[model samples]
Target: MHKFGVWAPKAQKMSLCWREQVLAMNGPNHRGWWTLEVQEATCGDRYAFLLDDDSTPYPDPRSLRQPEGVHGLSEIYSHGGFEWHDQLWRGSPKTGAIIYELHIGTFSTEGTFDGAIPHLKYLADLGITHVEVMPVAAWAGKQGWGYDSVSLFATHEHYGGPDGFKRFVDACHATGLSVILDVVYNHFGPVGNYTGKFGPYLNENRKTPWGDAVNLDQEGSDEVRRFFVDNAIMWLKDYHCDGLRFDAVHAFLDLSAVHFMEQLSTEVERLGATVGKEFYLIAESDLNDPRVVRPREANGYGMDAQWSDDFHHALIAVLYSPKEGESGYYSDFGTIADLHKSLKHAYVYDGQYSGHRKRRHGRPTDGLSAHHFIHFDQNHDQVGNRGWGERFEHLVGTDAAKLSIGIVLLAPYTPMLFMGEEWASSTPFLYFADHEDEEMRRLVAEGRKNEFAAFGFGGDVPNPEHEKTFLDSKLKWDEQEEGNHGDFLAWTKALIKLRRSHVCFNDGDTHHLHVFSDERARTLVMEREEARVVVNFGDQPFAFALLEGEQLELASRAEVSVREGYLDVPPMTLAVLLSTSEQFENRQVEARARA
Candidate 1:
């Protein structure tokens, strides 16, 4: 026996379409919910809902499994079907974690959950504590970034559905990797979005970049808010995910007293307590507001952390200058000073005038832990949104890319790496989507070209509608062991190994963090206790003064050499130096005891 329920307040008559039968449902019963039961219905049974004498059926607004497609019937799914092998997995905390973000559709050649499972051990071996999977929610079409999702409750069928997703998560846990799923609660896809036909899920008065904003605080929006909140819980609970990374949270315009984020966070905490597992909520925000990660008791959103774009922007701008009139948000960050500020303070625009937005932006993160900021040199947005979808190494040389990465990994914050970034894969992560609508495809391709042209990016923009675009974005796993790619991979592994083995690299004490930069020489030095990172961004070699007993731990390039009182760093190189004093070693023991 199975019970079916849906929130369709305006329906004059609601009916359940289970298998070949059409059965009338119960009433809207006060809270706009209609319920029905079928004794013969069981797991795997396909179902849809009918409203007001219409013969046409619509997929469940909270569909768990869209086996056929987003436009097809919903299938009943039970979470107990899959056997999980993570009973002993206590889950790793996001603090001091090395997160690896990958799009499931592009991370593997098969583009499915099962296909991605094979690489979990590789990531775990690479010292990744969390595997941040890009959106896997059911979206329209087979190939997409999963941002334009049509069904929030269902896993993408192309990625092997809900069962496949569970297996992947279980495999990740078995391989000692926690999973962080990227979820989009800001907007729905432009196509195959039927939530409006059932209830007020979107605010018509407000508009976002995609379409109408989600009805977070409008009339008849309590249930709408519950819908998204429940969706988040479903992922953490039934899917057994360790964390969720909210996508484009800055676009969510909620004016409620207890903001949607607060409500969601509060409920998630309760759920975590009930499940007896720690679950983190990460937000991808461009606002640079520290309140996003502050505690709820402090009148904040209570998010675990947020993506700090200023760090990436400052580092990238200093390493490789963008074309004139093409800076966008990078306009305010093209100097060693900006990088220096980012190292000391997480945000360069913390309550400062910005030439990018032409206004003062960002509040200071004065009393916050640096772990609340997740820094990354490249991500899906930074790479895929490019005119040609060039990776960081493609824009700059390998040495410069390595230099930027060394700073990010050694910074006093949680660091994330985009898929294939460890090996510096040559494949481009293009912005590709497959829309069934021909006109929508054409418009997407055209809009992509115009968006880049406006940013002063020249050359041909890849047609996002082309199948080749999606295929080209898939990571070539074979290249990981080829030529310089193999060397870079080894270098990255050594960096992460050094990060884990050293006590200073794991500390998030930004107050004690000291950074010095010379704009004329294009050199920077970051000192975290006994560890020092020396970077040379200039075309010419730079000599950096070293402390007594400071030994060279690692170098991005092979041209690093030690003099009597200084270390020589070749252009576009970064070198790590460690002071192996007895006092620092004693502190390491104390730190471990406190932990």
Candidate 2:
């Protein structure tokens, strides 16, 4: 026997379009729910819902499998059938964990879940503790960044569907790495969204840059909120994902006593306890609100961490100033002082006026652990949103890129690397999608051009509709073994190794960390327990005074040197030095005694 159900409050009548037979569903009861059981229903049965004499069928809002795409019929797939071997997998510790973010489509040539399995060991060898996969929810396209997902529960069919994703997660756990899935709950895609026909799934009165805002505080929002909360639980409990990175939390507008984020956080914590595993929730917010990562008991949103764009802006602006007209947010950066503040405070605009925003922004993040901020020089947005979608290494030479990576990896904040960033992949991760509608495709291409024009980038924006755009974004895995790419890969490995091995690098205490910088000299120094990071961003080499018994642990470039009680940091280079004060004192005594 198979049981089928749906929440259609407005439906006077409902019918299930199962393969060939149309079965009448029960009712729109008090809570706007309908249920029915078909003894003949079995696994792999394709079905959809017809409401109120509307012959057109709509995919399930909580579909577990959309084999024919978002607009197609949902298939019956049992999650319990997959044999998982991760019961023994106690997740990796959060402290000092390195996250590697990748789009499954572009990460491998085949662009499927099974195709990515071979690379698990490679990332583990590179010292990455967590593998963050981009959104996999079914969207209205052949290929996309997966941000405009329509079915929040169904895995994209092109990426090997639900069972495929389960296998990927299972492989990740077995490989000694954790999986963090990116989820979008702020808004649904512009096409193939039929939730509104069933209930108030969106707040049309309010708007977001993407489209209508999700219904969080409006009428009939209780079920909407529960819908999202249940989705989070499904990923954690059913799919076995270790964590979730909520995209654009700042866009979620809710005025309830307990914000949507707070409620979600509370439920996730409860679910984690019940599942017998620790789960993490990371938010991507432009608000720079400390309340997002603050504890729930303290009346905050209670996210475990948030992406820190301040660090990326500061590092990029200081190292290789953004191109003219391309300085949208980077206009607020471009100073060594900004970089210093990012290192010490994790937010450069904390309670300060932002010229870019034309107002004061971002409250201070005092008393928060450094790990609460995830820092990176490049990410999907930073790279894919550009005019030509140039990677950091492409804009700046090898030296500056290496120095920036060195700083991010060694900083107290948790570090994340975009796919192919470690090896300096030459491919550009341009925005690309395969929307079937001709008008939608045209609008996307036009929108991209307008965005670049606003940024003062003068050039034809790459057409996101073209298959070449998507193909070019795929990583050239073979190039990683070539000359400069090979060297950069080795450098990245060493930095990660040092980070994992050193207590100072892993410590999340921001109070214990100290930063010093010279705006004129274009230099910065970060001092931690028993270690110091010296960086020179100027056109000329910088000489910094060395402490007694200080020795170089690692250097981003070969030009870094220590001699005559001074550490020579060449332009666009960073060096980590260990302090052996005890050894220095003993050597001083021996020299004095011999004298």
Candidate 3:
């Protein structure tokens, strides 16, 4: 015997259509839940709900398995059936973390969870402590980046389904890497969505840029909110995931006193305690609200961390200078001072008036620790959403790209690297989706083309539906050992090791860091503890010493030396130095002897 339940508030009647056995559902509970226990149904059985006796049936909103795709009947999956080897896997809190983000479909040749497992050791060897995967939730398309998720609970069938995910996670844990699953609860995918038919899953009154906003604050919103909160708990507890990265949390609209994010965080914490695991939640937010990561006791949402897109923007503007014309949002960035501000204060526009936004943006995060911010130079959205999906390596060239990696890894905040970024893969991470319907495909393709019109960079955007787009995005994994790619990979590995080796990389005391930059000289000086990282963003060779005479430690391009009280940094180059007078004197003496 098995139990099946669904929330169908609008349905006058609900029936469970088992394999050739249709059983009428019982009364709707006070919460609008209809449940049925079937003696004949067991694991592996396929079933769906007949809403209001309509001929068309809808899959379970919280389906564990969707073997027949998003529109087909849901399968009865036994969650704990797989044999697990990671019994002693007590996940990490991931402090001062090194995070690597990968899209399962394009990470390797196989494009499945199982395919990704073989490379876990490779990532672990790279000194990455955590792997933040893009959303795995099943969608209508055969392949995608996994942002548009319809079935939030089920792993995409194309990625080897639920069991395969467990195996992949187990493998990762075995390889000393924690797993952070990216989840989308802000909105469901556009096509093959039947949750709207089940109940008021969407708020028609509130609209987001994507579509109808999720109903988190309206009438009968409790159940709808529970559906997503419970989904978070499912991933953390049942799947043994270490953490979750919430996608586009700003898109969630809630006028209610208690926000849905707070409710979800409360439930997830409770589950994490019960399961005895170190679970965390990170958010991709544009709201710039410190309350998102502040403690719940302090009247905040209590997310563990949030992505710092502003950091990426500021760094890109500095690294890829000589801009043609400012794009939509990039117009707001591109200043050496902006990068310096981001390094010292976590955000450049911390409640300051913006010329681009035409209003004050972002709240001060001075109270929070540096670990609350996840800093990265490259991510999926920054690259794939572009017209041609060119990586930073292509945009700024190799040397600048290498310098950017060093800055991100050594920064006080947690650092993340996009897949293949370390290796400098030749392929691009283009926007692609496999939609079966031509009309829907055309609509999506057209929407993507116009998305960047405001940004002058959106020239001749490719058809996202074209087969070549997805094929071109796949990473050339073998390039890890090839030519310049190998050199870049080695450089990244060294940066990660250096970060782990130094106490200066500790993200706890962000208040102590200092950033000084020369806009005209196009040079930056980052000071933390006894170490200083100097960067020259301009095309001309730059030479200067902030503290009269400093000792060169590690140079990105070559062995650095202080000539005439200035460390000569070549064009698009960088160098690490010792700020202590004693260490500087010792290194100076050694350099003179060698010369």
Candidate 4:
């Protein structure tokens, strides 16, 4: 016999309908929890619960796996059935990790978890240690970015559902790669959400961009908080994921003492201890608060890391300068000083005035490791939300594009690469959704075009609701084998190799960053620690003054130099230099360690 239980506090009565049998249930303590025993209901049995006076049955809110999609019946799944081979996998920590973020639907033509497996070897070859997939929870449509997730516990059916996810993760572990899943807990998708109809899952007392916020701190919220917290633990325990990237945490407008994030973190850590595995949580917050990543011992939320938008904005703004058109958030950060502070310190507006927010924002992250921040030049949000969904190469030239990639991989922080960014793919990552409602489709299309107009890119805004727009966003994998795309792939591969081979580029070090710009000389020099990166960001050849004892470790093969103390950096090229003494000493240390 199988025992089933569900929490439906508001319902007067509940019944479990299992394979042509209706089992009546009642709670002993008025908690509204109903339980039933079934002889034939083992794993893979279809089931649903009927509330008092409701004709339509509802899927279990805590369903383990929904192979039939969210709108269909829930399935009884045995989490222990799958064989795991990662017994010795201790997991890689956030420190010194290179994260590559991807969306399953558009990442490959198959648009399923199984389709993503073949690309794992490619990511591993690029020296990526972790793969951060965007939210895969079952949403309203057949195609989406996964942010519009309605079912927190179920994987999207179109992406081959739960079993397919298991295969994908298994492949990742086999290749020694950690998986980080992006999760959205602040709000539900706008469609196919039936939680509010059953109980008070939403709080009208607070509001967010997606309408009412989750009922985290409001009345009848005990079970509600448990509902979300249990979902978080499910991903870590049942799925064996290494970490979670919480999306838009600022939307969680909770005034409670404990806060939802702290409660979730505590539960995740407890689950990690039980399984003898390491689990982490990373937050995406626009508030720029240090408290987000601060440890619980210091009276902070204790999240592992966070996406640093300040670093991205500073880097992109400086690289794609003439930011008058369509740069949006990149417009306010077009300066060498912005890039300097972001590199040395994590935040650019630490207690300083932010022109974007028009207020004093952020706090100093003193004594914090660079591992606490994840840096990137391009991400899903940066490209998709734009008018044309252009990638970095679309905005900047080849040399500058390569320069941005070099800086991100070499910077002293956890780095992230968006899908298709490695080869400078031409496909735009646009905001597309398969909303069946015509009214919603029109609203999304018009809203997107109007939003871009405010940023001065209105004339050529593509209609987001068009089928062609969505089709245009899918990557053409054939491009990876030919022309500039092939060259970019080779360049990125070399950079990743250099990063993995050098300890100086690893996380957790603060070196003074100095950027020397000479407009007439057409050269820029960036010095960090014992190494210096010289770039010719102009049209003419420029000579760099190497320190007396400096030795050229690596330079763009296009560069030419006659002497040790002097080198000519060709226009639009990059070079790396190091002291001969330091290089030889580190080489010997590496050799001894290997021996």
TM-score of each: 0.97, 0.97, 0.95, 0.92
- Cα deviation in Å at residue 371, candidate 3? 0.3
For model 4 the TM-score comes to: 0.92
Ranked by TM-score, the better of candidates 2 and 4 is 2
Q: Alpha carbon lDDT of residue 159, candidate 1?
A: 95
Candidate 2 whole-model C-alpha lDDT, 0 to 1: 0.91
Give the per-residue lDDT of model 1 (tens digit) for 1-595.
9999999888899999987989999998998999998888999999999988778899998999999999999999888888888888878976669999999999999999999988989999999999899999999999999999989999999999999999999999999899999999999999888998889999999998899999998887999999999999999999999999999899889998998888989999999899898898999999988888899999899999999999999998887778876888888888889989888888999998998899999998988888888999999999998998999999998998888788878988889999999999999999999998899999998999988987788778899999999999999999899998999999899989998988677778898888989999988888888888888889999888776667898999888999889899899999999886675677667889999
What ordering of candidates by lDDT runs from best to worst? 2, 1, 3, 4
Estimate every model's Cα lDDT from 0 to 1.
0.90, 0.91, 0.86, 0.81
Residue pairs clashing in model 3 are none
Evaluated against the true structure, the overall lDDT of model 4 is 0.81
Tell me which of candidates 1 and 4 scores higher on TM-score: 1
> How much does each candidate deviate from the true structure in C-alpha RMSD?
3.1, 2.9, 3.7, 4.2
Question: Tens digit of lDDT per residue, candidate 2, span 1-595?
Answer: 6789889887899999886888899987788999999988888999999998788988888889999999999988888899999988868888878999999999999999999999999999999999999999999988899999999989999999988999999999999999999999999998888899899999988899899999999888999999999999999888999999999998898999889999999999998888788888899999988999999887688999999999999999987766678789889998899889999999999888999999999999978999899999999999999888999999998999999999999999999999999999999999999999999999999998999888877879789999999999999999998999999999999999989988889999878788999998888899886778899888899999987778899998897887899988888899999866576467558869999
- Candidate 3 per-residue lDDT, tens place, 1-595, comes to 8899999877899999898778899869988999999987899999998988588878999889999999999999998798888889887656868899999999988999999998999898888889999999999978888978899888899999999899989899999889999999888888878898889999988888889999998888999888998888888877878999999999989888988889888888888788777687899998889899988999999999999988999999877753454355667788899988888778888898878799999988878888999999999999987778989999888999999998998889999999999988899999988889989998998888777554555467878888788888999887778899888888888788778877788755777687889999998988876678999888788877546445677777874567777788888887887666566567558769999
lDDT head-to-head 2 vs 3, winner: 2
Best by lDDT: 2
Off by over 4 Å in 2: 581-595
